[model samples]
Target: MNLQRRAVRQNVEKSRFELPVDGEVALADYVLRDGVMLFTHTETPPALQGRGIASALIEGALLSARQQGLKVRASCSFVVDYLARHPEFADLQG
Candidate 1:
């Protein structure tokens, strides 16, 4: 679905980053504390699983964190695994 080109939007009131896909929304929930962004969960619709949507969402979130000069605490398992696999973002880990 060329997810890499898709944009993720942050919903500040909800404390989540969202990516829209095929009438559904993929989201990564988080809490900002001090200077850290703690990622708590990530979800993609059942019909959208295994489509790289979650990964794209996380990538966008991490990129946004970097731009905002925020550290990251990846409590979500998916985010932990993603950070492990993408060392380029290692500097953002808090």
Candidate 2:
């Protein structure tokens, strides 16, 4: 339940995806596209839910976006809510 940033990787095992907070019970992600990214999924393993891992995943994604110079398109509700509360990330919001 401690929200820690995890490594970022396009998981080869999953083949069709990338991961933020790798190895967390669950993960969240954004799909990069046309200089922007879509926050398409939010997942928290049953054991990790309600402990803010989803938020941490979102934060990891946002920081990754900043490092990549990309804007964010928050299709995921959790990420939209995160943006609402975190104005510092406003610059990266799409």
Candidate 3:
């Protein structure tokens, strides 16, 4: 793989993803909106949680938002908290 974070071409190819421990496994997070990326959700493989996989996915999502020039309504609590901790990305969050 070319290590893409914008690979939304397939249902499995995601807008938000994490490749933990240098790509040992991949997990996905997604944002769904009627007309925008209003909420973010994540599913890390059970073994991955203690490894910061969720944070990785959330961070990738925020970076993707900045790259796409999109704003987040932050329906996900994790996203809300992530925004709170990373004020530099606050401009992308609602």
Candidate 4:
């Protein structure tokens, strides 16, 4: 069995949610306005594409937004796809 370490998500100066992975960072960029979070971009390093870091980043960001009671607008296609796959977050969309 192969066990993989989980990525820890962090907010960097309130601008982006980041997951550090092997000398790189996967990021979900967002802008908060009028009780909503506009997800602007999502990027993972090419070397870290298959590691699940992006999922962790999105999960964490969405969890944070939920905890804060902020709605989400998934402008980033990655986030849109993620939301479709994870219905638990669908209610958070604005």
Candidate 5:
């Protein structure tokens, strides 16, 4: 499945990037301040875990931050780990 499509809807009003699963939603939460997007958490429903939903959620959230010209602060351990693994996103780090 195209995770990109799953994460296409970013609900900034809710401060999260969302992916609809089988009637559930996986989300990456964030806080935006001082030109930086602080990724705080990522979550997938128990049934939706292990399906790359969190990865897609975080990817979409980071991409949105990049497009908006915001730096990123990885406050969440998952995000910090993901950033460490994906060096291409290094440019987004604040």
Candidate 6:
């Protein structure tokens, strides 16, 4: 899948980044404080797991954080792992 082309929706009211795929919603939960975005959790429907949905969701969230000029604190293990693999986003880590 072209992760970059995926459309992610940010539900500011819920403090979550959402990616809708095949009728399922993959999401990453976060908390923003002091100009930092702390990713607390991520979930993908059981049927949608292993399809790179979570990765796409995280990438989108990271992109959004960058656009907002916010630093990142990845408390979610998946996000930590993702950041480890993608150094392009390392500069945004706080």
State the number of backbone clashes in model 6: 0
Worst 10 residues of 1 by lDDT: 1-10
Q: Relative to the true structure, how large is the alpha-carbon lDDT of every model?
A: 0.91, 0.67, 0.59, 0.82, 0.83, 0.90
lDDT of 2 by residue, 4-41 (tens): 65543444244213333435545665566798878777
lDDT of 6 by residue, 37-90 (tens): 999999999988987788888888899999999999988999999999999999
lDDT of 3 by residue, 1-94 (tens): 2233343221335655555544455444566555356655656666655766566666666666667677777656776787789888878765
Cα-based lDDT at residue 21, candidate 1: 82
Each candidate's TM vs. the true structure? 0.94, 0.76, 0.64, 0.85, 0.89, 0.94
Off-target runs (Cα >4 Å) in candidate 2 are 1-3, 6-24
lDDT of 4 at 61: 84
Model 5: per-residue Cα lDDT over 1-94, one tens digit each: 4655544577879987788878898888889899998989888899988877777777777777888999999778989998998898999999
- Point out where model 5 deviates above 4 Å: 1-6
| lDDT pick, better of 3 and 4 | 4
Candidate 2 vs candidate 4: the lDDT winner is: 4
lDDT: worst 10-residue window of model 6? 1-10
Alpha carbon RMSD to native, model 4:
3.1
Query: Candidate 3 lDDT (Cα, whole model)?
Result: 0.59
Clashes of 1: 0
What is candidate 4's lDDT per residue for 34-80, written digit by digit as tens?
99999999999999898777888888888888888999998899999
Report, for all candidates in order, the number of backbone clashes: 0, 0, 0, 0, 0, 0
Ranking by lDDT: 1, 6, 5, 4, 2, 3
The local lDDT score (0 to 100) that residue 84 gets in candidate 5 is 94
